[model samples]
Target: MTSVDITEARKTDAPATPVIEAKDLTRHFKVGRGFSRQMLHAVDDVNFSIGHQEIVALAGESGSGKSTIARLLAGVYKPTGGEIFYQGRAMSTFKSRKDQLAYRGDVPMVFQDPFSSLNPAFRVSHGILRSLKLHRPEFSRPQREEEAARVIETVGLTPAGDIMHRYPYELSGGQRQRIGFAQALAHKPKLILADEPVSMLDVSIRIGLLNLMAELRRSEGVSFLYITHDIASARYVADRLMIMYAGHIVESGPAESVLANPKHPYTDLLLGAVPDPRAPLAEGIEGDTGEPPKVIDPTPGCRFRWRCPLAIDRCHVETPLPRRLGENHEAACHVAEPDPGFRE
Candidate 1:
């Protein structure tokens, strides 16, 4: 794995000003009948900020609301409560379509399945040109095509000309993903909401795609909200990490710090579950292990208490406030004692 400079990444040249911020961001869906209906807390009271040029990974198992948070940040889903800000301005108040369009230009998304995301009918070149044409009409057809070719090359799709006429099915999974990258980059977005960008690709190609993204961070300064269930990749790519469970942020800190020294029990479970071939595999957690807790109209207490090994009486009775564990490290747990053997 490539080593990331977490210290320098944490200390931005400019004081950390969130290019995108979500304050108590939440979304709940009503499930079941009127009498028995319960709200499904997809994302509840989640808060975080992404500084300019920062890559923050949102890690959790399925149903952890990581994808829901991604959708909310992308403006695909409106928050049921709390506020969203873009560069300190209220994103919710971006009333005008033109205003929203302008803001969206700065943020584009790369979905998990590149094959499904891209149009099957349209040629790769045509699809890219379509976005460019709609977003930048000033550019003539040739100019758009030229820029498209450049972008395709930038994403490591060498001999970009050969792939222009190909359909999504014609290319390999990695190549198709590169095409998605090209599409997202066509707008020169300041922030890219990548939800498991490499999850569907072949294992061998995952590293190359990750390297490409890291290169984009260095060369273009594009911030990323990389959503993934894979903790190892999160550790590899994220400057910082946010652990989510049952619609809430359970822990967050520098990726190395969180991985090395998990404060929350949920965080510890996540790190413990990472597959390490070299070490003797430890016994896994029991009772629906590796899955996030249920979120159905949850009572006013901790969601993970049901599965948490460290759960106490207080954990079952009330929600735990976020406790400071270390510098820039915080975890929402009643029993977040610092571990002495913490290091990356």
Candidate 2:
């Protein structure tokens, strides 16, 4: 077994404290009519941590529970089970109004759709100013306005004065998304849960938004939980990557290492789906085609068994515990094996 050195993978002297941590974090929704209620496990037994100034990308296909995890972290949805911790403090303990306010100020979210996330009736500056007023009440009215303009410029919206006054419908999709980033920045948050912030923007503008995020991480020491389905974009921006399938985090580790050598079959399948210029048309991983398993009233066992080619009897009867592949890499698979071509 090839072991990866965690310290080397970090490549930076980040602080020891974790910005956010999820311990057995699970969120299940009750679905169906009164007599036929069933549980939909959106996020199940997920465990991971993001350190200060780190960018952890949560990658999966649609309905893989990536957005649900983001909502849980952002405190939009209360967990059906498990706990979330921020800076070593349990989120459940923040029951007091004051504590909840403080937590929200420190942790802000950027939603997927810029058009819908922002208020259509209000000007762009109104959204940014509102966040600043809520999070930074100490700032005077003039200071708040100045800070709002600064953040707009910070997010790559040039001529902040002109852009700030426009309504959501007035700006282009890319510009509106930049406004979303500006709103998140207005709070000076310790952590940002960006749920597909760039998925809706134009291809020409995707790189610009990604570069802005990278700049924030470098300049401001902001930690991010970037949720997306694009593995290629995740690799381009994140330091660490977590792969989810059927509400389970099947693989996670340093981004470079995991992408170069995936242990789990699901991870391999996701990577194979990424568009490659060199590969011939219709050339990709075969036989793994089907709708994802239904989450409602899910049966016990590996959820990926229906699509996994390597699944065996044990896989159908038992749930595999996460096996340590290296110092920081882990995969939940009964038949996981090292790739011979993989190298550190």
Candidate 3:
């Protein structure tokens, strides 16, 4: 008998509160000497929301500022403009360390480099135990050990006994990565900021991590902001997708829809470049293919016009804001249109 995929069926009701949200979130940095100083736009005027038990992938090239957004949400860097709200409450209200602890406990981050993220000196159990000690003070010594073992197993590191005693240097790349997930699991976070968690692993290993994320979301009711450059992996696991470029979110919507009917010229180009295993490889992508400029005190215009084929005079003078294309789908483009039409 054929089994039904229940993932789509479970989306009938909306969560009571948005797990986390960004309202025009912006972060910038000053670079160079005093006379030649300029503000580097790391992340600018970004907005999105993650609901309970959902996976949202922020896809972009290396310097596209997707990681900056992750850091902003994780509290590593504060937003220069706009605000972050968690469960309908503005983060600004939580000023003190004590006040922020609860929010921090509810959200954990898994870094990109797994081996570097964990300490080489300590056994694998050290971080998980520390996380539990800080976030779950209620658990006693025995309970903490039990909880750590459980989380380690939850990430598919079997026997927990065999895994817990080893140091970071003892494990393989994939095992080290699973330990990263286990560390976050110890917090029992509502949302996880996974900053390219699988990018550093081998191709076969990536599928395991991706499936682990889906399992965590399904089994624990956790949400995630999966940041990656590979749209294929994003498509494999994400329910929603946001495309970032030059510190701006050029397009966003449900993942499958955005991939199927890309509304922005940049989005279309990104999809075109993704390799199709069944089909033969193609020549270079047709557009300019130039690197996006370093956004230092950028002017009001579409940043992608330098490479976008459909760019017009209007794109040079005015910045495009995200326009709705379909249900929960939008793109920031001056020329592209919805289904049944494409024009200026």
Candidate 4:
């Protein structure tokens, strides 16, 4: 198991219990039947953690398996390799339906599309009420209504009474997304797995959602595993940043440290891919247009060699192990030089 070397202490100097921890966690899909059965590597040996009240951004392009990791942590998809520890408890020990439900309640998922996540036929209150019934069974229907209203207001939607009566269609994209969060809050979760929650919203509206996440961490002490391809938004909300490529966590560190000095070629590539509003307009976006590799029965080497500028011969034959770049900074690259005074 690859240790999450970059993990931070949630309280004192000592390491606090991570809300979610993955130890060489992996997941693969069966693509074909019997004779032609092929494994499509969705998430491969992913190791990371979300400290108490910490926001860890899992940034990657499509097919990078960011969403799969979210589902794995949420107990929706069973892992094919390794184990997941929630607040230091091994998920493998959870064998019964009651245990599974408890885990789901503790870690609720907020998906990308707000409209699709909620039922159009039902009013907005349906999901929150149902979540309360399933998870917080102690709450009566009246108490659920009051708690639901509080959560709606918590997400910055005022007059919860008015919003609760409306259907998913009546709300704006941003409002619908906040409603998704409200439903998750009904579970009284310790952690939230938000998968591209703002990518579909307008640029101005995106910032508001990002700010809401930051506030959630500050006010509620809730941790978040924010998965998205947008590096800029990731930097804004995440305390720690992890870059994924071809189903592997290629880099991880403090958000500022990783963004300013990306150790992996893939991390650098992702940052370079972000737009600079200050720069003049261009006919076409510059940089390598290479797509991330499709890993189906993948070879035993770096999956990013096809597009990496710093790929050496070592990257072709042997898979590169993550080497320390600095304190709380590591990058999986064979030829990447240490920044200044790194030991390994």
Cα lDDT of model 2 by residue, 1-344, tens digit = 00132223333655687999999999999889889988898988999999998889999999999999988888889988899999999999999888898898788899899889989988999988988888788999999989999999888888999998888899998889889888989989899899999998888888777777777776666889999999988988888899999899999988988998898999989988988899999685875965577688788789888888888999878887787776578899999874555433
Return the TM-score for each candidate structure: 0.92, 0.93, 0.95, 0.93
* lDDT of predicted model 2: 0.86
Deviation from native of the Cα of residue 312 in model 2, angstroms: 1.1
lDDT of 1 by residue, 275-337 (tens): 778766765554334334768877877899877766789987899877677878888988888
**Winner by TM-score between candidate 2 and candidate 1:** 2
Ranking by TM-score: 3, 2, 4, 1
C-alpha lDDT score of every prediction, in listed order? 0.84, 0.86, 0.88, 0.86
Worst 10 contiguous positions by lDDT, candidate 2: 1-10
lDDT minimum window of 10 residues, candidate 1: 5-14
Report the alpha-carbon TM-score of model 3 versus the true structure.
0.95
Instruction: Please provide, for model 4 over 110-193, each residue's C-alpha lDDT reduced to its tens digit, 9 standing for 90 to 100.
Output: 999987998999999999999999999999989999999999999999898999999999999999999998888888889999
Better of 2 and 3 by TM-score: 3
Model 1: what TM-score?
A: 0.92
Model 4: weakest 10-residue lDDT segment is: 1-10
